[model samples]
Target: MRVVTGIGAVAATVAATACLTFAHPAVAQDVKPDRAIKYRQSVLRAMDYNMDILEAMVKGETPPNKEVAAQSALFVEQLSHMPWSGFGPGTDQGAPTKARPEIWKDPEKFKSLQNDLMAATAKLAASAKSGDVAQWKGDFSAVADACRNCHRSFRAR
Candidate 1:
């Protein structure tokens, strides 16, 4: 009876795991436009918070720390990839989003801005690793300008 019970427990666990594994992709596919907009907004907010910290360090409001700079750069790099996928159809109008319809309308320009941001963030990450405050400032400014350029064309005021 004990052996039978153990076998039943193992079987139950396996079934549950299989159910979750198959269910996940289906659930992700069904994510609504509003959810996508909210997700991208959350990602941007996180990036903004990190950027503010880096900016403070740059402006001498806070003492410069290489570890913080490096971590902030890495955070920006990761967050940059989170928003583009959220710019799907129906996301342009349904939710409380600053994103303009031009994101979907002008695909080429949007792609260019995305590429610019990626490159700028990559440079920022590399500069952070070097622990040079001057280099970090320049790289951070580049990232900021990239963001502004995208916002000017893709985001509503």
Candidate 2:
């Protein structure tokens, strides 16, 4: 009887796991416009937080820490890739996103801005790894400029 009970429990557990696994893909595919906007906003917020920390160190508001700088740069680089795909069709207008409709209308220009951001973040990451405060500062400024450029063009006032 114990053996039978154990087998039944295992079967139940396996069935429950399979149900969740199958349900997840369907749910993920049905991502709403608002959810996509929120996801991009979350990614941007995380990048902003990391940039604030790095900016404080660069500006002497905080003590310099190579590890923090390197980690922040790497984090920013990863985050830069998260928002673009979220700028899909329904996300441009329906959601609370500041993203301009031009992002979808002017695909080439938007793509250029995305490329610029990726390049700037990549440079910042490399500079951080160098452990040179001045290089990090310069690269951080470039990254900030790239962000501002995109915001000026794509974000609402």
Candidate 3:
């Protein structure tokens, strides 16, 4: 328990030091476009924050905790289903965003990436439970690659 907690704290500290990404809640039906943007950012940022913990472990910057890793992966798996709602019509131009117009234009491609990410995270969540660092690391890479692939096509620099 302490180990899991300690890794989380250390992950937080490391995240604070690095150029970490930004967080937001669900948008109501009557929510403004900017609100949707905020909501999207929040979910992605939350994913990034949790991924940071797993990233640190994967990079060996901190010791890996299977429990902590599993927890983060599970959160990511759940989060993978979010943010798409925030990408509804008119959300392309609201607030500061890294999302690209391609996301709206080539939505099928974007949706495919979302599906890929969700699958990768699901696999990650399952693999993390076995506490096999090697398998965990490989699964982590698949998840990270899914993220990078999506960002390359759907998100701006």
The CA lDDT of each predicted structure is: 0.87, 0.87, 0.86
Please give the RMSD of candidate 2 to the true structure.
5.5
Residue 47 error, candidate 2, Å? 0.6
Model 2 Cα lDDT, one tens digit per residue, 6-55: 87989988998998988954554468878878888999999999999999
Q: Which parts of model 2 are misplaced by more than 4 Å?
A: 1-30
TM-score of 3: 0.79
Residue-wise lDDT of candidate 3 within 34-138, one digit each (tens)? 988999899999999988999999888989997899899899989988988899878888699888888878989989999999999999899998888899889
Write one digit per residue (lDDT tens) for candidate 1, span 22-140. 89555544679889888889999999999999999988999999999999999998898777777766678667878887887898999889999999999899899889889989999
Q: Once superposed on the true structure, which residue ranges of model 3 sit more than 4 Å away at CA? A: 1-29
Residue 148 in model 3: shift from native, Å? Answer: 0.7
> What's the lDDT for candidate 1?
0.87
List the RMSD of every prediction in angstroms: 4.6, 5.5, 15.1
lDDT of 3 at 150: 92
